[model samples]
Target: MSSGTSVPSPGCALTRGRLAGVISDDAGRPPLDAARLAAADPDLLPGLHVEVLDAAPSTNALVAERAHEGAAEGLVLVAEHQTAGRGRLDRTWETPPRSALTFSVLLRPTAPTHSWPWLPLLTGYAVAKALRAAGAEAEVKWPNDVLLGQRKVSGILLERVETASGPAAVVGIGINVGMTADELPVPEAVSLAVAGVEVDRTDLLVDVLASLWEAYTTWQEGGDLAGMRLAESYAAACATLGSEVRVDLPSGEVLTGTATGIDPSGRLLVAHDGGRTAVSAGDVVHVRPV
Candidate 1:
């Protein structure tokens, strides 16, 4: 569970559209190549450091530890296999070795601490936007789940921690890449391969990081969603908006309603018989077409 050593990594946040026409072959899962990634965007990633690990318990946990040790920002820790990979509410998902993308990026944003709740949605927009640009039918579900068509293809977890220097965020992202139908953990899950999008993992990673860094930079600007256009952009990219939804709350309560919009604090506004309830968090969110 170490942060691992810093390598001459290749992950440069390169062109955002590199995944648009990526070619996928049946040549088995190619290892994430540092050399190829390094050549992507050297100039743009001046201080960004990317580290690829063969196996780890969890990238999010490790990155958080590093931040506590006074680690700098822009450090990406990617794991090919996480024995203990987890999503929201302690839920777990598994992908065979090298079959998916699981990584975490550390950031110490300059935005107001109160507005940091938007970090998860900001990450969802980056992922969905990047994949959609690559021809996937991607849309963000509220908070930060990414769905291809009606099935989920990606999930994000943003953990906030107080470091010796300041508050930092560890953005953990997992995307299904090469799983087959039988390999899916659930029926509602799909992979890039299952969704008919063949892309190399490195290319996809670079593409996603580019989108994320861009969105993060803008949102960190005074944390103004409207001024940065993240509010409307995320609204357009979110599939939960205007859809009937069932939320399994952490308290074992069920809330069924139409998801109206995201409020300023990044809570989902659901209109139901109980009136419009602002859901701060949920254990599970099920979306049905209106």
Candidate 2:
């Protein structure tokens, strides 16, 4: 899946610096050097066309622009930092230079348009699986947050680009790697360092990419059955279930209920005093027991 500038294949004979020159985009994030990052893993997606940049306008925006410019699928846009990095609902995702992992995957799916709603949920599964593989008991929190013992560890944002070829998706992901407690902008936000877990960023990236590629391909190839399986997995891993919560809807209404499980459509199933309501989109906050 290597593209953009011609670079030697992963196993081909080339100098380290020469391999890094594959995506020497001045406007892009500094090269992450995937060769050095990935460990000897059996499952990691080999030969990923990685673009490294020191900082970027936004990984999602950059990848989307590249897709418009004819960038190929599996092209990963990674930023050492993002100047205007954003999350779902236009919230900012901050990262100091080389302090965290901020990246996006450009993918052209073979699935039908109806399957698009499942992308972000599947992305969460990928993060959870990767974190678990790293020896942390990571769990999903409804719509899109990954948590370790009730504290946030990672976030995902999936965007779609309607190309002439089809709907090209840019799945953006960020993990709090090496950021200290003092460096966090929000008091509520915590990092891997703060959580007392040390992990090689490169190794984590490899595992995440491998898991994500598998999840994406599974959904692409008649995995509607597998999607149900994933939804069940997500629900089981989700910390939101069985917790009294309030879902902050974009329409300015707070739906309060006890989160029971996730619906087949990937919406949250919350049982309120009145009845059960399925929320397609919202920010779910766990309510403190009174």
* Candidate achieving the largest lDDT: 1
Model 1: clashing residue pairs? 10-37, 10-38
**Candidate 1 runs further than 4 Å off:** 1-27, 43-46, 222-228, 282-290
lDDT per residue for candidate 1 within 1-290, as digits (tens), equals 34333345354532111111223433477778766666767644546677777777788988899899988899888777766888886788667777899999999998787778888998999999989877798999887999988899999988889988999999999999888888889998999998889888888988898889888877876445353478888899999999888887756678888999988777888899979988764334443454
Worst 10 residues of 2 by lDDT: 11-20
Q: What is the lDDT of residue 229 in candidate 1?
A: 77
Each candidate: how many clashes? 2, 7
- How well is each residue in 221-248 modelled by candidate 2, as lDDT tens digits? 8566888888877788788889888777
TM-score of 2: 0.85
**Cα RMSD to the true fold for all candidates:** 5.6, 5.0
- The lDDT per prediction is 0.79, 0.74
Q: Please, what is the TM-score per model?
A: 0.87, 0.85
Q: What lDDT does candidate 2 reach at residue 228? A: 83
Candidate 1, after superposition: displacement of residue 204 in Å? Answer: 0.4
Evaluate residue 156 in candidate 1 and report its C-alpha lDDT on the 0 to 100 scale.
Answer: 91
